[model samples]
Each structure stands twice: as C-alpha cells, then as structure tokens.
Target: MTKDEFIQELEVLIRARYGVILINTLEEERALDLLTDLARKLNKRLLTWSCTRGLVMDGNTAVHPDTVDLMTAIAKAEQLAEEPSLFVWLDLQSHLNSSPVYIRRFKELAQEIRERMPSNSIIVGPLMEIPTELQKEVTIIDMPYPDLNELKMIISQFAQQYRDRNDLQIDCSESALDALGRASIGLSKTEIENCLAKSLVQHKRITGEDIDFILEEKKQNIRKSGILEYVDTEKLETADIGGLDNLKKWLEIRKKAYTPEAEQFGIGWPKGVLLVGVPGCGKSLSAKCVAASWKMPLLRLDLGRVFGMYVGSSEANIRLALSMSEAVSPSILWIDEIEKALSGLASSNQSDGGTTSRVFGTILTWMQEKKSPVFVFATANNIGSLPPELLRKGRFDEIFFVDLPNEQERAEIFRIHIKRIGRNPENFDIAKMVKLSGEASLGDGVRLTGSEIEACVNQALLEAFFVRNSEGHPEGDVTSADIERAIVQSVPLSRVRKEDIGYMRTWATDNAVRASLAPESALSSAPESPAMAEVTVGRNIDF
Candidate 1:
C-alpha cells in the first residue's frame, strides 16, 4: 500500500482498537498535531514524551520533569492522570537494548496499563525491529511510494500555486499533467514537489521535454538504490544489424504499442522478446537496437551484481532492482548472456548451498507478477544452461532462435559494412566478393558475425589507403582480394565455438523455438551430405 493508504488504515485501526490513539512519523511535529486532534475527538488526556524534558504536553500545555526515565515518567503520569486514558508517543526504543531492566519494566508497565485502564502505547522510530517477545503486540507497516493519482494531485497543486504567484500563466494541459504524473510515480511527496518546482524553473513552462528531464533526474535516485543501472546506448539501430528479419518484423509490430495512440485503442503494452540463438548472431545487438528503435531508456541488468555476499541481501537487492524498473515504466531492461548468470541455479543445492536457488525464485516471481511497462529483453547463447522455468510462455512474449545468417543475409552484411566505412558499393566488384566469400569452406563462412565483417572492412580500408599512397597499386578500389586477405587474418567467434554452434542449429530445428530466419530457405541453403548428388539452384544473386 502507498503511504496515504497506510496512514488511513492506521487511523481506522487506532480508532477501532481503542478510543485513545497515538501516531509517530518522520515529521514528528506533524505527527503530534494529528495525534492531538484524535485525542480531542476522544475527549481523553493526551501525553507526549520529550527526551530532554520528560513527559511534556499533557493535553492542555507542556509539562516539564527533572527525570528522563521514560518508564518512570509514564508511571508518574499515569498516577497523576485526571481522566481514564492512555499515553502514546515516540523516542524510547533507542535505549531499550542498552538497558535490560528498563525494557523489562516498560513491558510490564505497558501490559499492566492496558489491563487496568483503556490505555494503549504506540512507539515509532525510523527503523524499527521489534523484539521477538513483543512481536505479537506490535504492527509493522511499510510506507510505499506515491501512485499516479496522488502524483497528479501534487502536480495540480504546484501548477495552481505557481500560476497564482507572479502571473506565471501556467497551462496545465492533460498531456502535460499526465506526463508529470507518471514521472513522479516512484518518488516521495517531498521529492515530487521538489522536482516539479525545479522543472518549472528550468523550462520556464512544463512541457513534455521537461517532464522527461525530471524523470531522468528521478532515474538517478533509482540508481542510488543499487539494484538497477541506468544504461545509455550508443545509437545502435536495426539498420546496423545484418539479419534476423523475423525478429525485426516482430519488433516493428510492437513499436506502436508504446505510443499514446495504442492506449486509446485499448491495446496492451508489449512485454518483451527473448532472443536465444548461436553465439555472435546478433542476439545482444538486437536487444540494444530494440531499445534504440523504441526510443525508450535501456537498463542493462548484470545478474552477478544482484547476488550479494550477505545472506538475504541478494534477494532484497533483486526486489529493489525490479521495483525500480517498474517505477521507471516504458523502459527496456536488457539482460545479456542470461544463461551464464542463471546456470548455477539449476543445481544450486550442490553449487552454492541454495543461495542461487533463492535468488532464481525471487526473479521468477517478479517476472510473472510485474505490472510495469519495462520490456525485459533477455539474450541467451547457451540454451542448455537456461532453466526450463524461464522458457515458459508467460515470462516472455516470444522466444526467437537466431541461427547463422543465410547467403542472402551474408550479402546484406557485406553491403552494410562497405557502406558504413564510406566505400561506394558501385565502385567495388561486390558480386565477385560475395561469390568468393560464400564459396569459402563452411567453417570459414560461418565464422563471420556482423561485427567481424565490419572489422574486416575497416582493416581493408586502411590497407587500400596504404597501397594507393605507398605501394602505388594499380587497383583503384578496395577489391575482393583486400576483403579476402582481411577475412583470413581475422579469427571469428564461430571458428572458436564450432561444436556449440552445431548443437544450437540442431536444437533450433528440433525444438519449439521459432526461427528468426525463413525456415524453408534456410533448409534449402544448408549443405547436403557427401552421399547426396550435387545439385544447383537458380541464377546467382550477389550483393
């Protein structure tokens, strides 16, 4: 429950349990006034405790005493009381652990007072951990962050107040109000008010941009909580990616769901997509590119960071991080190489004595119950390492298997890299380059990732300039020869993980995962066994 709801419930509980009441909050003076008003309604003597003066404010005026012993003071006040009422206030809990005698005496006095008269004692502090013996008698409640409606009210109040002073002429449009309201979702009342005031001062008028700026500022506070890191991507786009047409199409369809128009049409926000595939086939790149395309903030979750050394701290950290992600709605949460992080959880009992298992449980619960618009995009290279619970449908919208780029995709990869390095494709013989590259041994061709191809082109360009200036080479343009030389020199991830890639391809074909590439086309292009007759398909299409 939110802070207001918690307070309202407390008020009702206080009234129903006993006619007398007491409240304690961070704002001590405000708490005193609220309790005093409740005391007036019951027509009972109200008592407060001051650490230095001892037993002050007995309904009418402040009372001073020479002794500061709270238990003794409470006893003396009860003895001198004119009306049959209870004492309620704060500031005695800190010294409870220091003095065992005082704690025992206070508990006995509290029990006796409650039994004899219609009296109740309520103690409040910043962080309260009640002793096990008194746990039954005390109620602990957590004050939650402000919700949308409360935030809207706060924005409205600020706009109205600002408009009244200095003829500010503030126009509180519904869109602007909504933006501000959402921006303040996870902030405290004081924090929201402060941010609103600062935003007004910075922009001169609160616009959507100002609202975004305020939300970015609030994101810093979320980061300070130490659960989630605010990630800033370096302009990675779908165009920079070479293949994964199915994955791209899937993402394009969901892009509209983030807009206000989709909400008007009653379309639910997209949850996220899971990319599971062979290593270096653009799974991680796709995660970053999706966030870039959606124009939302991206947060990278390093699972290792969530596992703490202290017991129970790891679980708490995970909850806090998930809470922050929810607070910053309409954002992308990227968990790269998830298999490595969660692999230990499969046999956590044998591994770390159940710490990993507990952490896994916490994440599973959050993934299922989370209501926030934070799209969770997790990429896994090793499917065998992933727990079966994560593959379930409700956890992610879809699971896409990114296999090795096909012949068509390989040509696209070449063109993308050539253009990226400011080389005119028409000037170079792309067809020969594609033919030479595709004809290479399966191990050589499959070794190339989108990133590796880009690196090859870059190296080729540097060689081209060197040959033209120093060697006075006859070849004016960067040819297939240059690219071939670079490819041979470079070692790709596929070469290093050949066995793993073969396993992934077999798994994709047999398993339930949807291929990110065209199924029929991929099957046709795949190499045939030596036993099969040599077959040739249609005319050659090159880059």
Candidate 2:
C-alpha cells in the first residue's frame, strides 16, 4: 500500500482503540516517520522501546534507564497510565517467542488495551511471530513496495536536489521516465535514491541511459533475496527467433495488452502461455525472448532449490518465491521443465508425506488468484507427466505444442545462426543444408531441432579455425562443405525418439494449440513418420 493509505488506516485503527498492531516490514525508519506524524495529528503521546535505549518518550526522554530487558520494558509500559498513547516495540520478535512469561505479559498488555485502556501496542519486525493465543487480537500490515506514482515522486525529488548545480543535466522523455520508474520497481527506496545520485556523480547527467545503472542496482538487490534468480540480460527480438510464426503473432498481441490504451479499453493482461512439446524446439528460448522484447526483468524459479531439507521449509520457500515475484511486477518468471517439478505429485502422499503435494498446491492457487502482473512462462518436454488439473481451463492462457521445424523453417534457422556469427548466409549453400536437415533429403529420417541446427554452424566454425593452409595459417572462414559434414555426422533427437514425438502429437491433437503453421504441401510429401502428422491450427490462413 502507499504511505498515505497506510497512515489513513493506522489513524482509523488507533482512534477505534485496537489492541495490538503488527507491521511486517523492512523499512523501520519509514514506518516510524509515518507513526510520528500520526501521533502528532491525534495529540497522543508516542513511546518507543529498544533493548539498549530502554523506554523513551517522544524522541529521547527516558522513562527509566534501568528498564532495558523485555519483561522490564513491558512492566514499564504497563505502569505508564497515559490515555490515548502508542508504544512501538522494535527488535522484539527474537526476544518474545522464547519465554512463556514474556508471551503472557504481551497477552495481558493486549487485553488491558482492549478492555479499559485508551492506548495501543505496536510491534514492528520481520514477518510476525505472534503467539497462537494472540492471533485474533493482533492485526497485520505488510508494507508493499512503492508503486509507479511514488517512484515518480522519488525521481522528481531526486532531480530537485541537483537543481542548483549547473554541471548536472537531466534529459528524459515522459515515456522514458515512466519506463524508468517501472524498471526500479523491486528496489528499496534507499537503493533507488543512491542509484540516481551515483549516476550524477559518475556522468554529471541523467537520461534514459540511467536505466542500465538502475537495473544493475536491482540485480544486486535480487541476489540478496536468495530465492529468485536474476537472469543475465540477453536481449533478443522477434526476428532473432526462427519459425514459430503463429506463436510470434500471439505474443505481439499480448505485448499490446500491457499498454495504457488497453487498460482504457477494459482489457486485462493476457495470462501467460505454456509451451509443451519436442525438446530443443525453442520453448525456453521463447521465455528469454519475451523478457528481452518487452524489456522486463527475467527471474528463473528453480524448483530443485525450493524443496528445502527441513520438513515445512519447502512450502515456505515456495510462498517466499511467489511473494518476491509479485514484488517484481510486470516481470517474467521462467519455470523451465515445470512438469519435472510436479512429477512426484501422484506419489506425494506415499513418499514425502504430502510435502510435494503441498508445494504444488501453493503454486496452483497462486496462479489462479494472483493479481500481480507476473507472467509465468513454463516449458516442458514430457507432457504425459503433467497433471490434468494444470491443463484445465483458466489455469494458463493457452498451451502450445511445439513440433520439429519444417524445411523452410530450417532455412530460416540456418540464416539466423549463420548471420549471428558474422558470416554471410549468401556465401553458403543454405538450401542444401536445409534439405539435408530433414528426412526428405536424407534417408535417416532426422529433422534437427533449433539447437541442433545452431550446433551445425558452431561445428563448422570450430573446424575452420583449426584447418591450416600451406602457409601455416588458419583457414579462418567456414564453407558450405564444412557445415554439410557436421549435418551428415549429427543425429537429431527426432530420429531416436520417434515414438515419443508421435505420442506428443496425439496428445496435442486433443488438448493443445499448434505453435507452428503446417503447410499442406509439405505434410503431403513427408514420409510415414511423426514428420507427417496432420496438424490443424487456427484458420489465420487457409491451406
């Protein structure tokens, strides 16, 4: 929640004489500043306690220099018979949970405040450890990260600080400033301020270029969280990915759904898609592409690390991971090979005593009820292992079944990989390599996946780097013959796993959407194998 909204609610609760208020936050100074203003507006005495400071009134007047322990502080607070007062207890979570005597004293203090007293007890610390008996008496407030409006305020205040300095120049468009605020979403307010200040000291200028510096700050912040991984920035546009033309169209429309115009048109975010099909068909690559194309932070949720060694730790880890994802909104959470994470669901009750089931349930509920703009980009190769509940309606926007690339897509893939290495595609016979990649050209019945096709170009580069001419120098440039040798020697996974691909095609026919458009001419001339599977996609075009 915004600071204004939080202060408003706190004021209302204080006037109504609530007993105990628990604030779960890391921003102690920010919370205290708001509370100080609230106490002034209500004309109530504000008291604060710490182990070293004992009991202090309104800033620093000591109630008792001897009252420093937890029990003594409670007793001292109880003695202060002031009407309409507030006691903010700092650094108490670690001390109170140990002793039953301390717990009983807190319960009595809460009761005294509710029954006859006119004051309230406020506990500010990490995720609350309130005693089970005091659950109903305490109310929790989890402070939310700053929103875009608050971020803009911070940016304005930052720019104001350097208004007198002629050396500092600020250049930012309205849209770029908005983007900068969104990029700085998950960082603490202090981190954001420090980043903006550091940019001025380094370059004496603020522009759209400051975004990279802010993003670098975010990388450090995410690393400290220890739950979500901040994926390295590898930017890829739609043009970089080859063949998934139908998927590309769908993504292009989804990108527009996040704009302000779409909000005005009453359109919510399009739920993310689940890419399930053949291995190495660019499913994981699509996740990275979306993060780069949309300019959103990419976080990978590794399931292996989430399942902790302790009994209840796995469930807690999943919740923490999901919470962190929401904190970084308008971001992509890439869960690669998701089915493997849930593969033990059926036997969860028997093996780990429902730990796996509980973890899976947490994710299922989060996806359905989450209001955050965290797009879950999940990919999998084993569709059979996935539970039917995950494939149900409204769980994901859609499930696209990726298949092996056709002849034309192979040519496109070859062109992309070759050009990426600074080699001219025109200099090589790409048509021959495309034909050789499929079963139509060779009797081996192998259709290389996107990764396998890239491997062919890499293999050619390695061979050319080693071959020496008569002058004892490296050949330095790859040839069409070099790539041809790599293709002839490599065996694609499609050839070895024919039955698995056929089974996946059968499953897709009943339950999933097609990722690529299949041309009828190509399907007709294909051999009697998984390559000839008759797939019918949406009628964006007629065959």
Candidate 3:
C-alpha cells in the first residue's frame, strides 16, 4: 500500500485507542516524523523515548531527564499527565523479548493507558520481535519503504533547503521532479536527502543526471542486506543473449507492462516467468538480460544464504529479502539454479526440524500472493527436485523449457561468442561446425548446449592464436579445419545426461512451452555454405 494509505490506517487505530502499536521499519527517523504528524491530527502531544535519552516531548524539552533506566521511563509514562499523548518507544524490542519483568511492566503500562485516557504507546524497531505474552494486546504494522509521493516530497524539501544558496541551482521542473521522484522511489528520507546533497556537490545542480547517484546508493543499501546481490548490469544487453527466440519475443511484448499507461488500460502487472531446462542453455543469461531489456535493477537471491542456523532466523531473512525486493519494485529478482537451492523438500520435516519446509512454503505463498511489481525470474535445471506446488498454474505466468540449441541456434550461438571477442563472425567457418554436427552420433544425441557451442569457437580461436605466420606472429585466420577439430573434441551434456534430458524433453512436450522458435523439423535441416571460407583475425587485434 501507499504511504498515505498506511498513515490513514495508523490514524484510525490510534483514534480507536489501540493500547499499543508495534511498527517494524528500518527508517526510525521517518517513523518518528510520521508519529509527530499523527499526534497533531489527534490533538495530542507527542512523546518519545530511547534507551539512552529518557522520555522527551516531540521537538520540546525532556519530561524526565533523570530517568535513564528503561523501567523508570515506563513508570513515568504510566503516570502521564491527564492530557492525551502518544508515547513512541524506540529500540525497545531487544529487551521486550528477553526480559520477563520488562514484558509484564510494559503490559501493565499498556493497560493503564487504555483504561485511563486517549494516550497510546508505539514501539518502533528494525524488526517485528513482539513476545507472545503481549501479542493479543498490541497491533503490529509493517511499515513500507518510501513511495513515489514521499520521495517527491523529500526531493522538493532538499531543493527548498538550497534555494537560498547562491552557488547551487535546483532546476526542478515538473518533468525533472517526476524523473527524480521515480528514480528515488525505494530510498528512505535520509538516503534521498544524502543522495541529492551528493549530486549537488558533484555537479553544482540537481537534474535528471542525479538518477545514477540514487541508483548507486540503492546498490550500497542492497549490499548491506547480505541476502540480495547487486549485479553490474551495464554489459548485459538483450543483444548479448543468443538463441531463445521465443523467450526473447515473449519479453519484448511486455516491455511496457509496468508503466502507468498499462495500468490505465486495465492491464495488471505481469507476474513472472520460469525457465527449466538443461544446464547452460541460456536460462540464467536470459534472467540477467531481462533487467537490461526492461531498464530495471537486477537482484540475485541466494536461498542457501537465507537459511540461518538459529531458530526463526531463516524466516526473518526471507522476510527481509522479499520485503527489500518489494521496496525496489519494477526490479528483477533472479533465483539462479533454484532446484538446488530449494532441495530437501521431502525430508525437511525429518531433517532440519521442518525449517526448510516452512521456508519453502513461505516463498511459494509469497510468489502466489505478492502484489508488487518485482518480477521473479527463477531458473531450475533439475525439475525432479522442484516442489509440485511451484509448478502449479498462477505461480508463474508461464513455465518455459529451454532445451539444447537446435542446428541453426548452435550456429547463432557460435557467431555470438566469436563477435563478443572482437572478431567478425563472418570470418569463422560456422557452417563447418554445423556440418560436423551431422557426422557425429555423440552418444545418443547430437544436440549441443549453448555453452558447448561457445567452447567450440573459443577452442578454435586458441588454435589460431598458437599457429605462427611467416612474419613470426600468430596466424590471423580461423579455418574450417580448426572449427571442425574443436567441434569433434567438445562433449555436450546431452551426451552424458541423456536420460535426464530425455525426461525433461518429454515433460516439456506436455507441461511447458518451448523457448526456441525453431520447429522440431529444423533440427535435421542441412547447413548452408559460408559466404567466405574464412576471415582474417590478426588485423583486428589491437596489438
């Protein structure tokens, strides 16, 4: 929900005299600011307390300066003046769960406030660590990160703060402000302020150019999370991804799925897609390319890292990861090789005290019920290990099986790798590699994965690099004989894991959509002759 809607809900609960309200958030300062506003609306004085600083009126002098102990602060709160007030307790969760005496005292204090006057107590912390003893008496609210409107307000305030400074200029046109607002959606008030300050210091002004600074700040924040890894996505364009035409086509159609116009047209946000197939058939690469294709940040989630040794810690980590993903909506959450990460599903009850089972259930439930625009791009190689619940309809928009590249796709994969190394693909004899595919049985199958095709081109380049020319330099040309040799020496996973590939292929026939547009008939088609037998590579080398 939006921040304004959340504030309205909190106001209702406060007016209804909810004895104690527990808010979970990392933005302590922002929460306090919100409480001060709510206090004004309720016509009550705002009082705040911390472990170090006893009780102090909001923006006013301390009420109990000598009371440094937490118990003493609670006693003073219990004896509040007859006037209604809102008591905001900061960082009291650690003791609330550890000390029984403190718990009983806080419960009694809550009862006193509810029975005596319109005053209420609020506990704000980084997590919702409420003890079971007071769960019935306290209302828990999971505060969300700053939304677009809140971010715009933060940007406007920063601009106004520097309006008097003659050295700095703030060009906040409606369009510029909107761009900054959208870019700063996931940042907290303090982060937004700090980012804007840094931008002004570096550029002497705030404009559309400052969005990169905000994104860098987000990367730093995500790194601290530990569960989510930020990817350097500048090099991951859709053009770099080879083959998977059907998958690429599917993604292109939904490029504008998250825009305001789509929503206005009654189109809901696209849920996500699942890629299941053999290893290294462009599944994970496709996951990364989506972020670039969609112009969004990419976050990698490692489920193995989420499982903590302590009780309930694993669940907390998942909550943190998922919450942070939602905070940065219009982003991609890539779960690579998900089957291995979510393994031990059947024996979770017998082994890890059902922790894995609970964690698995939590992820599936979130995938099914999440309303945010964070797209879940999950790739799994071992379909047998995956839970049946994840395979059910609606969990993912569609399940795609990325099989081994067909005849034409293998040639395209070869061309992509050659071009990536700064050599023209037309110089290499790719048709010779395709012809070699028809000559070898390669165990039970001739299909090669995209990775194996890349290896063939790389090996051929190595061969060319070692061959010397008459000028005593390495020969510049990669020949058909070099490619043929590399293709014959390379081994495809389809040869070693024949049964596994066969089962997955059989399953894909009925349960999943194919990732490549090549028809099954195209697999047996003959190769075309190359326009040139070989192109020289030595001249293109910078050395």
Among these predictions, the greatest lDDT belongs to: 2
- After superposition on all C-alphas, the RMSD of every candidate to the true structure, in Å, is 6.5, 2.8, 6.4
Q: Which model is ahead, 2 or 3, in terms of lDDT?
A: 2
Q: Which segments of model 1 are wrong by more than 4 Å?
A: 1-142, 164-169, 200-203, 256-271, 418-445, 461-482, 519-543
- The lDDT per prediction is 0.67, 0.82, 0.80
Model 2 quality (TM-score): 0.92
TM-score per prediction, in order, is 0.75, 0.92, 0.93
**lDDT tens string, model 2, 1-543?**
676787778888787788889887777866777788888998888899888998889977998888788788888788783567899989887777788888888889988887888899998766755678778889887766777877877777777777677888875557756867888886667878888888898999766678888988877866776777988756577787788887887887888888889999998876688999889989988888888888788899998888988878888788878888887778888899999989999999999999999999899898888888888888999999999888887779888888888776788999999999898999999988987888765544458999999999999888877785544666457899999999999988998898888788788887787888766676677543554444443234222
lDDT of 3 by residue, 76-195 (tens): 887783579999998798768778999999999888877877799999887665788898889988788887777777788789877787788787677878899998877888998899
Of the two candidates 1 and 2, the one with more favorable TM-score, higher being better, is 2
> Can you give the lDDT of residue 138 in candidate 2?
91
- The sequence of per-residue lDDT tens digits that candidate 1 reaches over residues 289-324 is 888888777888888889888766777677667766
Which residue pairs show collisions in model 3?
A: none
Ranking by lDDT: 2, 3, 1
